[model samples]
Target: MKAPGNVIGFPRRSFGRASAGRSEPADATDEMSDRLLAVAEHGDRAAFAVLFRHFGPRVRAYLLRAGGDAGRVDDLLQETFAAVWRKAGQYDSRRATAAAWIFAIARNRSIDAFRRERRPEFDRQDPAFQPDPQPDGEETLATRERAESVRAALAALSEEQREVLRLSFYDGESYAAIAIRLGIPVGTVKSRARLAFRRLRAVLGGRREELR
Candidate 1:
């Protein structure tokens, strides 16, 4: 039997890339998208297996880059694809490519995990403040699902755009600090962040309104 949390085995063969170290042609992503859509439409375990092999490591790497615990990454990995299994049918290829869609799932899962472990700060000055109400399971999940659309917006960003945003928001770096670390000027860091935020708002703003 497969491991308890895993839906498929790790594939020994590398996918999409050729043996000569050349990147696969453009259709490779589209092919993966079609396969994922197949799993969505027909519940194909074999197709899910292929996707797990291709994206599993990349998702884990994303969580790691966002400061997830090494020990928990495997569990997070399991949770992410489990969600993919349940929610794959909702994926819209026209709105987001398969890889981008999967990454959005991973991002939302990470956010959910963070929320579960986070403790809110307390301040004595506000008498009107009350503790956050605990959400029922269905409500909690609904919120996480909504975050997927926002993450899809993030997936549209260029790597440079995403990297700066990750450094600034995920790692909580100041603009100057990010510039220093990336060996770029502070103006460039700010520019990248501005462009990323603009794109995110442009893409996610309407989606957020729809959820409302």
Candidate 2:
């Protein structure tokens, strides 16, 4: 959904400018986090207005730098913040800083734009589209067991640790990219990833011993 003009209460033309050169202060970040929590818990329009004003131009600049068309960047920016508003309850400060969570949403919006632009028409009759051969009973059972073990190990992790693992391995994002997306230092990203891996190894290793 587009950000309502009245809701943002800012000059639309200003969105073309980049905010990256400016460094956000620690106190400002803490205040933003508190405002976000306020919006999540109370549906406070004033708090939301604060977020929209702060993030609107920044997200617009980010989308443009990420190769988004200037024409569509405004729409993407609106959608990104709209998602933040709708999904505020899902935000966990323990998992990521406010900026990181917001930028991650912006990154997804940019990726979605690219996917839409390059999407190919599906061919139902193509030989390459054939389904894979069904696995034999033993193979299927083995696969199921392995998947269950991995799921269990993952479940043992804290939410923040699982997010690092997902972004690093499942999403194939680089540590630097994850740092940018999550609004943390690269060192912090690496620490979380290292800790996550150590925990996974301990959990999975214990399961292997049990199976043996």
Candidate 3:
């Protein structure tokens, strides 16, 4: 299935160049939704193909705009579509348009990728990875002190800033998702997170310096 002109036109260098000079129909959004439903209900290959052609480039563009590298963008595009295929039954046209549903999947895939990159790799050879050993007096006291410090830092934040930080880091929610949940703008979520982190770093850094 050929994508409509409206669906094409991501940067030429990002993925392969798309065909120029095309346009989508007025009923394109509804049409896409119907195709997704067909795939969900009947496992329709043709309908799935059409949906892919239509949304693939747009999803690629969105991922790139979200700061994904070329390699990561391609992988995320595949992951996002795979999720769409698997979750098509959950799509509700009354609640969200097909494009909205597909893009939300893409956004979540991007967030998962980012979190994976940020996570520290565990080493099998490290003693810490071995069966747990009871902590001695110094170790136990140090652990308690660190936990107390973190708790104090968190307590110092304003309610809004603390909530944003909790949703972002602890709950692993994307800024866009948090914004939707909080009924605030995405920019506000980002701003609150930034302020919260800055405050945390200042407080934690001071504590470390005193310990040294």
Candidate 4:
């Protein structure tokens, strides 16, 4: 099973390149993982199917642990595999656990699913209503403003930086996928992304002083 923190780009894949060779003990799952990654990278449907059978349960389990609604978990499970299809080339086993990468991807997919459907069903005296009045206040406004500042800072970045940031943050792309899509080295991709994040942090600066 994928461990945690995956960032799949497309649907199922023929295992692609990244972790060409890492010093790790040989095991059944690892061996299967290697094959799954290679064939999946090439868009082999059969390979993708194998991957799904092996890893899909793990992804589903992860979602369940995260408090996923049983009704929608199945749908999210399919979406996570789809992401794997488009991003097989980005799996660098050396830099990340195959399991962890898969986990992260599934987690991101679940969160994205929620965000896409997130909206309060408003109705007077609704069953979901809470007793807390004046919940929306200046504090909430300030927090939102800080988020906007971060978004603005991201917008100010170089096109490549912004793209990577969005894929990494919103789309749950790993450094490897960002490199493949951007035609840059993984190191360069990570460095650029780091710089972007740092810049955003500075732009929204405050020791809980100004922006805070």
Which candidate leads in lDDT? Answer: 1
**Tens digits of per-residue lDDT for model 4, 1-212:** 45222324332322232234244333224444554466545555655665677788878877775557987898888888877876777675533445556776786677666666653434435687653343324433332244345557878999978888877865556789778988889999888889988787677543324323
The digit string of per-residue lDDT tens for model 1 on 60-139 reads 88888766799888899999999898888877665567787898778777777765566344443479777444434543
The whole-model lDDT of each prediction reads 0.71, 0.68, 0.70, 0.62
**Number of clashing pairs per prediction, in order:** 0, 1, 2, 28
lDDT of 2 by residue, 15-81 (tens): 3222321353322454566667767876656668878888788888777777767889888988898
RMSD (Cα, Å) of candidate 2?
15.5
Backbone clashes (count) for model 4: 28
Off by over 4 Å in 3: 1-27, 116-212
Q: What's the CA error at residue 151 for candidate 2, in Å?
A: 33
Candidate 2 deviant stretches above 4 angstroms = 1-27, 116-212
Better of 1 and 3 by TM-score: 1
User: Each prediction's TM-score against the native?
Assistant: 0.54, 0.45, 0.45, 0.40
Give candidate 3's TM-score.
0.45
Candidate 3, residue 193: how far the Cα is off, in Å: 15
With candidate 4 superimposed using the best TM-score fit, by how many Å does residue 189's alpha carbon deviate from the native?
33
Q: TM-score of predicted model 1?
A: 0.54
